[model samples]
Target: MRNPSLAPAPGDAVGALPSHWPRAVAWALVAATLVHAVVFIATVANPLVISDAWYFVDVFLRKYVDGQLTLGDFFAKRSAMDHALPFHKLLLLLNYRLFGVDLSVDAWIGFAFAVATLWLFRVALKRATPARDFADWPVQLAWVAMCAVYVSLNTSEIFEWPLLTLAFVALFCCFALYLAAWRALEGARAWPIVVAVFAVTLVSDGGGVIAVIAAALATGLYGLRTGETKPALRAIGAMVLACIAVKLVSWALAPPMQSIPMAGGPHAAAVSLPRLALAMTVPLSSGVLYPMQAQQVFHSFGHAVDMALRLGFIVAHAVFWWQAWRRRPTAAWFLAVATMLLFYGLCAGVLIGRVPQYGEAAFLQPRYIVFYQLHVVALLLMAVCWYVERRPSLDPANTKRVGGAMIAACLGLVLLQAPLDRQAWIRAPYQQAYVQRLAVQMEALADKPEVAPDKCMPQITVCRMPEPVRVRVVVFLRDHHLNVYSPAFRQRHGFEAD
Candidate 1:
């Protein structure tokens, strides 16, 4: 079978049609982006009002207000995400200083980070594409459209999550680091920038350190064939050493953590492989373990349509990997390959840490998918780039059909995601209404009642709320010097019957 890369992209006019195809495609991407925004607005809750959000923000502010926060505390304190992400910590500080515990302002701050995170991925994918075909309008359209679909899959869950932000920050920094390496190869001055981004990634999340290792591996592998291995090796050692230094310091400064009984045997890796694969594809089904396992034909058609988009992505990258190795593996190819390896490393780390931590429920939550989904998306984008670079010899006509099919498949998925995103099975379980209601109740509680407070004066618990959201809600109340009717933690200032 002829490789799609060696053929025409469907509807490729060879510039014969005066850009009939490219304009329409570009408009399609624009429409996708708009629709993505609409879906996000309609379905997602207010950013500042979410599980664990107000609680984390309140903890930081409470410490700061009581003069308990120090520079040392900034590095040492673990937030809801369970690590010291200076990026997130710094954002919290900014929100407090500028907004004075205002939720509206804080929400926008979190949203800004979300936008930056997604944009960085878009930029990284575009950079990974070969420069020759990258200029083609068709490729640009394809690029934006695919990215929009992925981002809109769930608006990054559209809430203020400290850990998620940490992950996104690290992912962005990793992409930034990769771009810096790419520029350095092009004879641009980028090492200083690389060093800065590397440090940022390390502190941002545990994943950041892995990303540093991944970027270095990509550059180092490219060096092996190019015979410029010395510089890459030097950079790799410096970054790894730095990453280790920061993490150790963080560990020393932070409180000691209890060790969990690890379930890391050979079976751990075996168990993780399929979970991660299913997790990676969860976004396609708008965040389900298996959206395509539909029973009814009415719903099955949409599943088929959406799964085709994801399958096309998988097939494209698989072919690109097969073909790229047969030819010269460029720096971008190295990046793509290393990123896939990074995903495996991420999966291994997760299963080892989580399985023992949560036991049977470790792999149940689709939320775990967020940590490595970008790696899958990155591979898909890079695969297309690799294909374009390899088959520059082919005319547009020969290349457009396959390319068009992939792009068409992507555009079709965009339409399907809008409805699925709102209707996701996880949506009902993960809704932010309970947290939102709690936010309002807290505001009203700030003022004392003329009469005595009721027994359930601060009944923060909502029966409808799930455990994850309920726990965070209780934390927020306790942190703000309010009474929580729990045996374990009835606050000091709060009035509770002894």
Candidate 2:
């Protein structure tokens, strides 16, 4: 296979065809962008508001009311003490300050990030594989479309809050590095661009490790093409500096990680390899449907069947990995696959004890694998596009057919999962309504003279008591076997009753 760097520019127009193909692609991308933005905003804003939005809103409100904000506020007590990275927290804080602590505002903020992510993906794909054949465009577009739609609809806490932003920044930085490498391959001094890209990738997320590796791989490939290693070494140095800087900055801030109490100890052996593989595969087959209780399709088959399904997922990923590597041995493609494998291994270790079990352990919780899924899918898409672009004899019509099939399959899965997502969202209100109603009831009792205001109210006043509050209060107190004026209520300002 010819190096993509050696291929003629897309604008060369060597083939006898209409001159407007490139322009047409540009227009299609624009339309896709608008449609994607609408879907993103609608999904995030309506009945399906993710629970993380509530947590973030609460954190923002607490800080806004208190006149202070810190990374420690985002995690539970134990997690805060462990001092997790604050990059995402900082972004969320900035958004909260500018837009207020409302779900609608946050949804828009998330939507903007989602759009930027798709844009970066398009730009990266264009630079990474600038195909001249009009047939290759559909494959490239299909990859972008799948990523955009799946990511947006599956919008979990990690994707919506911070990781989505991180993914965009990482992709943008990766493209910048790709451009720099491209320049160097063309005999230009582009070290400055390389350094800038390195810095940006580092500050984005720890996962930028993948970007760094890709850069190193690119440098090596370029060196092989030109028989010089200095450029590769320089790229490596930049990546090292970026990683060091991120670590140093994180250590300096060192926000508390002990805020959130963890359910299990730090034992990594609990994560099984087979389980992890199954968890990872569930997303590809079911999109984000596993999170919805009404849509879970794999639970009742017993442990042995679960293990078999997990093995199947591992086999699928293995095939994907082989196909990508065989299609093209580019540094970016290799790095993407390796990083994904490493990430899968780590996640599996945390759940099922080995790299292969990532699927079973991951299940369908959006929070656990949102970023991971995106990276894997993106890399797979990149590999496919690169392969389609390089094959000289491949028919444009055939490429589109295959690309269309992949896109249709992905969209079909997403559509099938939509109803379950909606049901889950509708159920959310009921899940929390009881607690909200109880709080209202407690407020009423605190205002009643018979309940002893001092004993029930404590320091906080239950101002503006609503009618029928006592009725709710009596029902809850009797049902729960609790005193109307429990001492614990007074101790915690009646808020504890709820």
CA lDDT of each candidate? 0.50, 0.45
* Model 1 TM-score relative to the real fold: 0.69
Tell me how far the alpha carbon of residue 40 in candidate 1 is from the true structure, in angstroms, after superposition. Answer: 2.9
Write candidate 1's Cα lDDT for 1-498 as tens digits. 322332343333243334455556765665556555444433443323333343444445556767876665555443223555655667666755654333334334434555565565556545555444554554665555545544444433433233343354455566566666665654566555447544565455566766777777766766664566666666666667767777777667665332211112223333455665665554433322134323222374756755764676567557655654553444445556666656656666556566545543454444455544555555555656545654556676867765676567556545655554555434534544543544445444333322222332232222123444434444554455332232222222122333
lDDT of 2 by residue, 15-128 (tens): 555356544664575466457545544443321112233233334434544667654353322342122324445555564455332223444554555556555455545444
Which window of ten consecutive residues has the lowest lDDT sum in model 2?
A: 457-466
Return the top candidate by lDDT. Answer: 1
Q: Model 2 compared with the native: what TM-score?
A: 0.59
TM-score of each: 0.69, 0.59
Clashes of each: 12, 48
